[model samples]
Target: MDDELVLDPYPSKIPSLMDPSTSIGFLQPQEINLADQCFPRPQCDFFNPFRTMDGSCNNLQYPTWGQANTASTRIIQANYSDGYAQPRKSVSGHELPSARKIRTAILQDVDKSSPKINLFVMQYSQIVTHDTEFTILKELGSNGPLKCCNKDGSTPEIIPKECLQIKISDDNNSHSKHRCLSVPRALDTSDRGCNIKPVRQMNGVSSFIDASILYGSDHETSRSIRTFKNGKLRRQLGPNGKSYLPNVKKATELCNVTYDSTVCYVTGDPRVNIQPDMAVVTILLMRLHNYLCDELRSLNPKWDDERIYQEARRLLIAMHQHITYNELVPVILGRDFARENYLLPLTKGFDDSYDQYLNPTTTTSFTAAAFRSLHSSIRGFIELVNEARKITSKIRLSDFFFKPDIIQKQDNYDSFTRGLLTQKAQEVDQYFTEEISELAVRIPDRHQHIDLISVDLERGRDYGEPSYNKFRQLCGLSEAKTFDNLIDQMDKKDIDALSKIYEHVDDVDYYVAGLLEKSKPGSMLGHTFQCVVGEMFFRLKYGDRFYYEFGHQIGSFKLGQLNEIRKTTLGLIVCITSDIYSVQRNMFEIPSSRNPLVPCNSIPKLNLSAWKEE
Candidate 1:
């Protein structure tokens, strides 16, 4: 009854010769005029204090090095099937394991919870992910909306080049009736520039930790969200008479609203409506902006709306960087590794390590594979907690996709905020709950769903990522010559599972292999991911001239103001912005005996008086 094509997991013949001197192919088949290509050459204001909306002008010589809508960089040479634009293939030109099948075998439901890391860690990671990476998935084709499969759930006779749909075999019990899962290819930099050589995907957001998710990446979105008079963002009245994110008039296209009364909120990123936790964080940031705006206006009465706005923005960004490096990075990479790699912030003075030659553009390895290891930590339900820290109710994560009205209901916002502080996150491992595997991104009315694990696996191939062995070697680990070589990194059971599914050790996918590796001491990530993520954070800090701790730059914060930023923490931000009265000093970790809950006032606060100008 199984119609799935089966092949021997072991290789039967020698791989084709890898040509070293191969010429590169242009992304477009036709020749393009080089002179007509448009590039960003922003006029740098050397003395300006604010960053450009699109992240240009950061580096004086290279204006668009890490700007929005630019092509992502690569750690190693791409391995495209055509050496240009097609998805990557195995060395022997055979199909790799089905992403869905691999998911079923390795990442089944295991309902495990972390010991100390709270739900806020997962929520903040998603926020950080949105800040640094966004690959625009192309949906439309020469026709209207692209559909790669027939109405009867069968593959089309002629598949479009843009559709990289994952084929579901007849033996796939989870999707027995579905033959394929439609996936649109990511947009590349060909339309803007870089029409030459091996194709790379475009990062739609500014590739920096500059809070592009709070303020918009482009000039239009930024200007639209402001009131233009009080250095404040536009807000809406919630059911509890508190200010919340403004609602978009037309959201049926963006949000999956089940009822007419269910409203969709708008923010800097359209993905805010993806879930409840994302919307909660966005709303909290909005409140912090207004709260800071009021304080800045009172302190610097002579300053105009623009000065107050830019100053407040700068301060907020500084706090974000501090919390990310100081609080968040330590937990993921371990305090020791972060210090050894210079990824942690200095406790006292300014950091003078801004390097002009380094490119801060995010690498494809970090985006497509390494950072995705955190996906296993997502819990099935969003728990709601009362003021007493007792779980009151819970909502399934799958039911709330593209629907964020839950936060707008009476007293629910505070309940969810408390929940993030109290609930424990799922442990990082091979297992994923049914909420993520069976019901992720579900469309109830259409009776459709997407397997996130499949999407991740397919995305790596689509981006032409190299094999797991290649990445392991790059990270200074021993080269895996045989499947047994993986024993040092993964358990024997995991290695056996991989050996059964893959033909050779070299054929393993980076995303799959990275997850199976045992985590390092005091860190949540494995050795390979720790290397990739650690390097990225290092570049993000040392390469950006506007980094808060870096002095002597036009955009640099003053020593006094910098000290105030250094005092800021994620817990304090949650406290000052929301109605929650007490939380642990470090919200990234749960309240344990060692890290006890304390009143909000006792926590160190950002002293805005330091920014007072005569």
Candidate 2:
């Protein structure tokens, strides 16, 4: 074959059929098939119905393919800290302020004011995040034992000092053994340290939100949870006749931690048992899938189980993409940024902007730092309400952690679903509720609790994310040379608090600095975070070959189906899945005079007839 011709520029229009070829024996084209040549239809056989399981679109072999440092030599030069350590006390040779101390200082509860955003906004943010990125840390084996502080009266072992959190006991002793291991980074050909690997689904990680959060990423896990019936997932009817995830056998066997209750339901995602809200969202999506399956079966009666399952899965994934782009993303990133970044999908037809060369893998920084910024928006308690918007009861978020059985109780799911709509999300600020700040997961009858803020900061370092200044420069912002530079982005008090822990501005952790910065207008994130997150979603939307909105792809939704997908929203989804009677038109925003709650029947529903085949 002749050497491939590389053209820097080409003619705007193809030569007409009447025009003769410049080269002998060569034919002149009348039109150019740019879509086929540039982005050929993907082979559907390899496509996982649950997710775009193959890494052909994304850089799976090398997940850190598009990072600032991709060269093997550059990995050696990268800075990898054991943990985010505090500045030293010069005289005493002791650490001045600890990570926990800094957390308590800047992340303390200032006011319990709920923001204008609704609870679904917070839930969707977390659900979308869980779908894309999940970084697993290396557990301490027999070799490394966690070190306990002398004050706690527990056996002391050797561990990284920076990983310890000073936990004060009821006896007035400070026990400092909260072990946090560094996340193992991907190794280069020579086995040198590189970017951290996402343990969750990485292939087309951004496409259709990976569905890892809905169906567990592994095939065996997904198969175990699925019923394989009429293309519908298995679900059990609760005492109230509402659908709930089927309970697993010996649930204790699947516990992530010792304190977790063993009696949890088996869902596509194992994290369903991690938190009540997570379970709620997972069950909601599962129900949506079943509902779509039923509709598709009705429309295509002759379709077999496999055909119905694939189409229903396709529609379900499209619905998720639609909600994320149209409903959830606009509220979180603000409408302006959503439009500016091309995150919004067209109302009808296909988008031909899918770039085969673009990698859709989730970034380590995004998973470890930027996306986790929403922790500040989490309320300490989960409220249950009635149609009258009356609060029936409030459940502490920490208390329900890893104990999803509470949602399985009689009428509890309905109450929680109602609460999701009526309740307001915590304000988006540097301050976090005490439940999340100090007592993230409290084991029943156990005195110890995990602090999420500490985990977030330490996780950033473990993932080998660069300092705040480095990321700012990476995101095209000026690197802060002095503490004063951050003043514009962060409050004076937060700046003072950060300075006390970090010796220099360059040493600040990305999670701490980014969360403390002032949020962009109509957004819950700061400029740097918004830039990183916005860019991530932009690539996720534009780079995937099988993106639901794009027409003419091998397995993409039909134009009419895509239009129907655009009609889908979180409000309609909740109404279809749950027993809720009324909801706000824009479920992502708090119910108000402008967006008031209406009867569930009043909400617009997606027309399944659009998916009908003649």
Candidate 3:
């Protein structure tokens, strides 16, 4: 009765908690093999056929293992020496696993921590597609500068103190990227980037913000590409469309891989192009979503809210430091040298990468559907934030979730949205609603309105190639607010430079909303959206690749208490974690025993008979 072969709906196969020896455990990978079901004929209908696949794990543990599956007990020198036969009882009738299995488990655990990843690749034979582990903080001290270099971990002649960090623990996400190990702001923890425990204790990091801001610390950022010729259009973009000051590239150095424009490739410095704050934010949101997704599921049965918030906030802070320093600055400063002109690749992705990479399978139909749905959800999220600000006079309503919202609602909006948002905010700063405004008018049809709500509620983040070209334009010189003392003095008969600029931003929100609204729905788009969210999560959780695989493999930093349950219509997963994310000072719990999400529920199936338990 292999669990995979059983024909039942979640039978009670887990071991009893009452057993003191239950101890902690993790999953290991194994071989996969299965047959495809057909209707008494070689050529089966293509619409929906039973495609069976096998996924195996090495641990051979029984709770997850089924009846008749043999358990391989480790023959330990200490166990044998402990006197179970100390007195030299008659030759035992017991049988032990072959030496090969014993050696494999011991060696694998030695090379890695815990056991194995608990996931299965669809249609593929792999049992684990991701490597989830722990990170120990290696602080750079409060006043030290942040920096990034080649994979060798080389120190730069000059260091940028800002950084973006991303990290992931046990994965609860269906997509690999959602498990993160990255952050966007400066942080309290540092890592040598491996599972090998550093001697220092794990000092929990805060979410991205002014360190003082959380304690209430400081937060901020830069770069250059080209100059705008007349009628060439000043490319800077922002709220109300104003030009910023000319790009102030750090004059001393050539920009390194500045992610500005096409020409940056030939001439601009790679270091000069700074990574976008949005990218950093994207990673932050992704990291927490990735890192905690699984652990929370493990403890999904009865974990508290405080534990979730505490874990999310800490991961966010670490990422802030990594993103700001490593990727953001280098991306912004390269194109202009002065940090001014040019377009980026984000938009061209539709033409360049979207067709070739993203929509290779389904083309426009499905991706557009999911994209539009996500677009609506994001817009609605923005509207809700604005509504809160209008009512409370600041963008502090989110804080109420952490601070005052509980007082207002008693139980608060702690459902999937808040949970997802809180997890997202943990990775990025609370920057989700920086520039969103909806039309004051709403169609009075309640049914239509409810449909809108459903669309908004279910929408996930954009996974289509990002529109970075627009982002660069918005952040460049053209978008900065103008300020000159002499302008007022000459204003009596002077031409208004400000009015000329004002027209550009008059409908920024409305224009974007229309585009978002037009995006429709489909399964492919939904999967891509899931992938994008996963990618962003990975980036945020592991903002710096300097450490490699984000250091998840070498840890005793196993999953501790977890709490996850976000089977939202949006296909979003919100997870909460604890000390287990970084410092491994605890035990592992039963996975999915508590998670309401049914295994393989996310991936649609044409044939349920294969997965069904009889």
Q: TM-scores for all candidates? A: 0.92, 0.79, 0.19
lDDT of 1 by residue, 1-614 (tens): 21112221221110011122221221121222121133557688877788988888888877776788877766566678788878876667888888888888887889889888888888888888899889876656466566667777788888888778788877776633777777777777554556655777788898889888989889999888888887988899887689888888766666787554567887788888888998998888889888899999999999898888888888888888998999999888777777767888999988888988666777788898888878888889999988778889999998898888888887888899988988888877787878767676733224567788788888888777888887666666658899999987899999999989988888899889988987776678887787778767876788688889999888778889888898888889888987888898778878888888899988877788988888
**Model 2 Cα lDDT, one tens digit per residue, 1-614:** 21112221211111111123221111112111111122223443444423443223233232332221122111001234322222223123333345566676676776555556767777888888867654432223455433333334342465443233343334321232443312122312112222222111122222236565666655566677678878877787776687888777665555434433344778755556767888888888888888888898899898888788768776777788888898887777767667756788887678888765555545556666788878878887889887787899999887777777778787777788888877888767677877776565532213455567766765555445566776565544556788888876788988888878777777777778888877766666776687667756875676555578776666667677777788888888888988888888888777889888899898778888977788
On a 0 to 100 scale, what is the lDDT of residue 167 in model 2?
A: 38
Model 3, backbone clash pairs (residues 3+ apart or across chains), number: 125
Q: Give the distance in Å from residue 246's predicted Cα in candidate 2 to where it truly belongs.
A: 1.4
Candidate 2 global lDDT = 0.62
Q: Which 10 consecutive positions of candidate 1 have the poorest summed lDDT?
A: 10-19
User: Cα RMSD (Å) per model?
Assistant: 7.5, 11.2, 30.6
Stretches of candidate 3 off by over 4 Å are 1-375, 378-408, 413-436, 439-548, 551-614
Global fold similarity of model 3 (TM-score): 0.19
lDDT values of the candidates? Answer: 0.78, 0.62, 0.19
How much is the lDDT of residue 431 in candidate 2? 77
Candidate 3: tens digits of C-alpha lDDT, residues 136-188: 21235674323232222333444333332122224322122222211112121
